[model samples]
Target: MSTENAAVNFSELVNRNKQTLARLKESPRLLLHRRDGEDLVLTTAARAEQDQTVVSAATRMLASLARREPGGMELLLGILPDVFPWVRFLPEPDLHAFTVELVDTMRAADSLGNSASVAQLLITWQHTAEVHSDPELLAALTRDHAEDYGPATNPRDVA
Candidate 1:
């Protein structure tokens, strides 16, 4: 075999692998690898969609509780990091707003087990700018001032 022919064959194999990876990225798909005697075949598989059963169950629980308690959205945010660790990096106020909007959407629609949508909602919310400025509003949100390092009383009297 000539070097040119070998290079062409290598490029073809690379293209085939790329196609397989692309296919595996959509939902869930698997290729069959077969081997008989000396014959061999390569296959690829990936779980593109994460298992949402547990997430849905949690969302259902939140929805049921929200139906009972008006502050269910707040409660969910209070513990959102337990499930979505990256969300902890987002500002608390943005998260609060995101949770409120998601709760509203979930309530408005007949969606009780759509945590994926809720997560997508958070992703959308994160793209926006932060606007937590009002002290009263921040306090009402159960969060302290962002830059309050002075003494509670007048610090002028301190040496």
Candidate 2:
């Protein structure tokens, strides 16, 4: 499916995903925007489950792409925008760890001599505009996914 970036109401978007998982696959690049003041509040359990689902699904998709072409690292830059509505909602350390791995992968891909990864790069900017606008979504993502984030691709000891 083609990537689309259109202005949308939060409520409408949620309703759009009511037939989720199956539907989410069809709109992998569909970015959502909220009409001002439309809040999407989730109970803690609901938030945790959704967070887990998003992380799992996004990670699986990214990993597959990475495996298909190592340049998939360039693709990771889109993770925040593509999988998530709010970048700020993402936990910093987890995101950071992921980013570190992404960069390493990108560098490895470069060594393998790729000219570029256009589709991967394109979806990134397409999704960036919608990030950082929703606190509720961010809270949910951070709370549930933080502890589960690692076994980092490269684990390290802190001083």
Candidate 3:
């Protein structure tokens, strides 16, 4: 075994165990944040429901990744309808705008090849939206993303 071959083998071993390497290969733009005494995997439904801070942190990380990656926007946009299913039941301007922005960000992220981060963000957003029922907000979101939302029609008529 020559020095060069030995060095190459060592490098490969190091790369295999690194989390960043796995992320880069599996989902390059996805951001993973470490919390004190927190497990990366949520084993049960109760644990997932009880972990608000972890969920919020994950959301922020996704938002940050979308901001950093332009292609992630499309994925973000795709998430709106799925996250806010009750958008057809309420009337609120601010929530509507927020949902629109989130969708736009996803679209942008997707364009930039940040689909993984967008997916992660969507998961977090859906979970959060489910826990906090804002009828108006949900309705507004549904209205804003109606065109690209497949079966869901936009409540307002636009000419």
Q: Candidate 1's residue-wise lDDT over 1-159, tens digit each?
A: 121211113334456866554443342433333333332333232222233444555555767776577876668888877865656656778677666676676554325434556556666654442223445554666666588777586678767
Instruction: Tell me the lDDT of candidate 1.
Output: 0.53
State the lDDT of candidate 3 residue by residue for 44-77, as single tens digits.
3443444544555565667766566776555554
Q: Which residue runs of candidate 2 sit more than 4 Å off their true CA positions?
A: 1-90, 115-133, 139-159
Q: If ranked by lDDT, best first, what sequence of candidates would result?
A: 1, 2, 3
lDDT scores of the candidates, listed in order? 0.53, 0.49, 0.49
Error of 3 at 119 (Å): 1.3
- Identify the candidate with maximal TM-score: 1
Question: How far out, in Å, is residue 26 in model 3?
Answer: 25
Model 1 residue 43 CA deviation (Å) reads 18
What are the per-residue Cα lDDT tens digits for candidate 2 across 1-159?
A: 533423345566567656433343444333344567544432235545665566555545666675567666456655655664444444556455555555445554444434254336434633442343456654565475435555655445653
TM-score: which is higher, 2 or 3? 3
| Shift of residue 113 alpha carbon in model 2, Å | 1.8
Candidate that beats the other on lDDT, 2 or 3, i.e. the better one? 2
lDDT of candidate 1 at residue 126, scale 0 to 100 = 48
